[model samples]
Target: MEQAVCCYRHQDRETGVRCSRCERPICPECMVSASVGFQCPECVGQARPERQAQRPRTMTGGAVAANPRLITMILIGINVAVFLAVQAVGDSLVQDLILYGAWPPVDPTSGVAEGQWYRLLTATFLHQNVMHIGFNMLSLWWIGPGLEVALGRVRFLAVYLLSALGGSALSFLLANPNAGSLGASGAVFGLLGATFVLMRRLRYDSRPIVAIIVLNLFFTFAQTGTIDWRAHIGGLVTGAVVAFGMVHAPRERRALVQWGTCVAVAVVIVALVVVGTYRINH
Candidate 1:
């Protein structure tokens, strides 16, 4: 005989419906319409806890099924993977990815700069060594999620990437052309600056952020040769500018203003790089 097909709740009433979540047989009377499909009462009751467990969490909100800080996690993963690859391949990876001050600029080692301009962005994903990557990754982990939540994923990513470019542009203008620089320091500093601006916007006590920034700046300058102060300052300034635009944007025109601000900042950074490069070449 064919297996009996009946509602779990009402065996006497045969029905084709099933709980979408648990796949248990359900009668038309027991069917509860959901966004996707019908569900039984028991499944509906269990749904809340299941959703809570399945959802990704944001720093200051209820769990949502949408991935929280997904970009931040991806960034961390890429950096870690690059670090591991670098460990395996050695200095060759660094040489290819490291940001030199300027393309076509004179260099002692290679005689002339041959690295492509994309190195500016790629360099942010590269690191000098374990300690360097460790500190930068730690800073990203601390500041990334909260900022990601506040800005939303795309905007947060924009701030990070633009800040990295800003840092590299500044390094191009200021650092010795022959010197190689690499790491996520610029992006980490960008997150710090964004956090500072956001805290100020929310009228939260921003003194602690200021203190952290100051402490970091102090280390940046004090370390001299080891630290790239130009990159730090550039990233900080870019992130602050972006955050300021985000905070000050008119409620009715927020997205436009924020994105426009990012575009404007990018154009300015590019112009600066071109001008600096021209001056250096001439």
Candidate 2:
């Protein structure tokens, strides 16, 4: 018996129903009902044959699905872990430790030796309050994955570290000489700025992103209470410059150029901080 049928996917024709897999119309006599729907005999055989022919693709997809990058997750975990550790150590200790984590340029006259140069980078991993770290880490979690996917692990790490260092350098130059600051907002702002540049370079729609960044900048200036506007500006500019370099550089030389430019910019920032500190001390 022959029955009128329509295409399963397109539903426009009354011709014999096409096979779910191969879309070949089959008369009732040739159609076979399967677990999902009716499949033509040719389709069933072809499905099996094609599966046998391309078995490797299935395996590769499975492998790709299983192996996600662990580095970003590990960094978030460490940040949270350190926050918890600071909490355990108590509040007064946290204040002192946080101050220690901040980068204060060496005073040339008093010869105030720099305690820890690593603080330029490490301070970015610390946050002033639970709410502060929570928000920053959340932003990192949301944006970090996409960036890591686009730029790969090494480049992503470079962008983050350079941005942090840039922020620290700015703070050391512009902040009150006796004051100390620590937070991940600088690095987070860097990621935000880099994202804008990346979207623009890719010719992706950027209206929403521009609005968000503008609002954040407005909020930074509006809010008082020890907010480090200088650090935010520094990190944002550094991230944008680095992202621009990456987008323009040749594919093979992009990573090298991006990293080199970031390092060079960081050196210039450090020099400026040193010069500023000498001027202040003298």
Candidate 3:
């Protein structure tokens, strides 16, 4: 009767085959075939040293890859940098003085004093305090990656710029003649709004995002400290409209339609600003 083959590593029974690297008898289970011959578990471990010696020393270079969140961070950095530069050149009080902090109706009598016409858009990027910019940037950091990945850079930028414009326009329309406001909240809100639409279209779970947006809206109206509810509302509405239009438009007609829609929105916003300016001046 033939004896049963045993594992060479175990050494409890008859030899099945010899280890390839080690010429030792191995059971079928323990036998490991290598290029030269069957190898035992011990031989495999020993071979690792030789393999390691042959491999390249530097597994990865020192250069770090950029994280997707970096873009939003860079933007926040630029804003802070600008603010710091402003403070360094002028008094700390000057930061508040020039902050896109102008009211509507360029005050013809006062000769459009202090707040310049360019501030409408510029102000949206400025923040009053560290807490203000910090929170806004935090929101951008949390939400930007997903939107940027989904929409690609160009569309994401468009959404942001247009939303900023929308927010500024709303502020122009609804703000008190003398009230001045500045912050990235409007554009941030627009990003939230756009993401909300995109997520819904992709059939992603949007309940959490929707809840966040609603809460922000509630806070916009509920909180009393320098919140520009008009800008928030305007950005929200404009972002949703732009997102809907972008997503729903026919693919073949997307470029033409989007450009046309943007132009039309711009015209309307410009018209509103002009009308408001005239009203304030007259």
Residues 80-190, candidate 1, lDDT per residue (tens digit)? 999999999999878877866654445323212332568778888988878999999989999998888877777788899999998988887677766787789987888
* Leading candidate by TM-score: 1
Per-model TM-score on C-alpha atoms: 0.76, 0.68, 0.68
Which one wins by TM-score: 1 or 3?
1
For 1-282, candidate 3 gives per-residue lDDT tens digits of 976766656858687577766677777676566887688878888998998666431111111224545556676787787667665676453333323212544554222233345656667777767798789888888888776666555556677778888888777766765556677888889888988888788888999989999999999999745688978887887777777766666666767776676777777767766765666656
Q: Candidate 2 clashing pairs?
A: none
Candidate 1 matches the true fold with a TM-score of 0.76
The local distance difference test score of each candidate is 0.81, 0.67, 0.69
Clashes in predicted model 2: 0
Q: How far is candidate 1 from the true structure (C-alpha RMSD, Å)?
A: 7.0
Q: Give every collision pair in model 3.
A: 8-27, 19-38, 20-37, 20-38, 20-39
Ranking by lDDT: 1, 3, 2
Considering summed lDDT, which 10 consecutive residues are worst modelled in model 3? Answer: 56-65
| Candidate 2, poorest ten consecutive residues by summed lDDT | 57-66
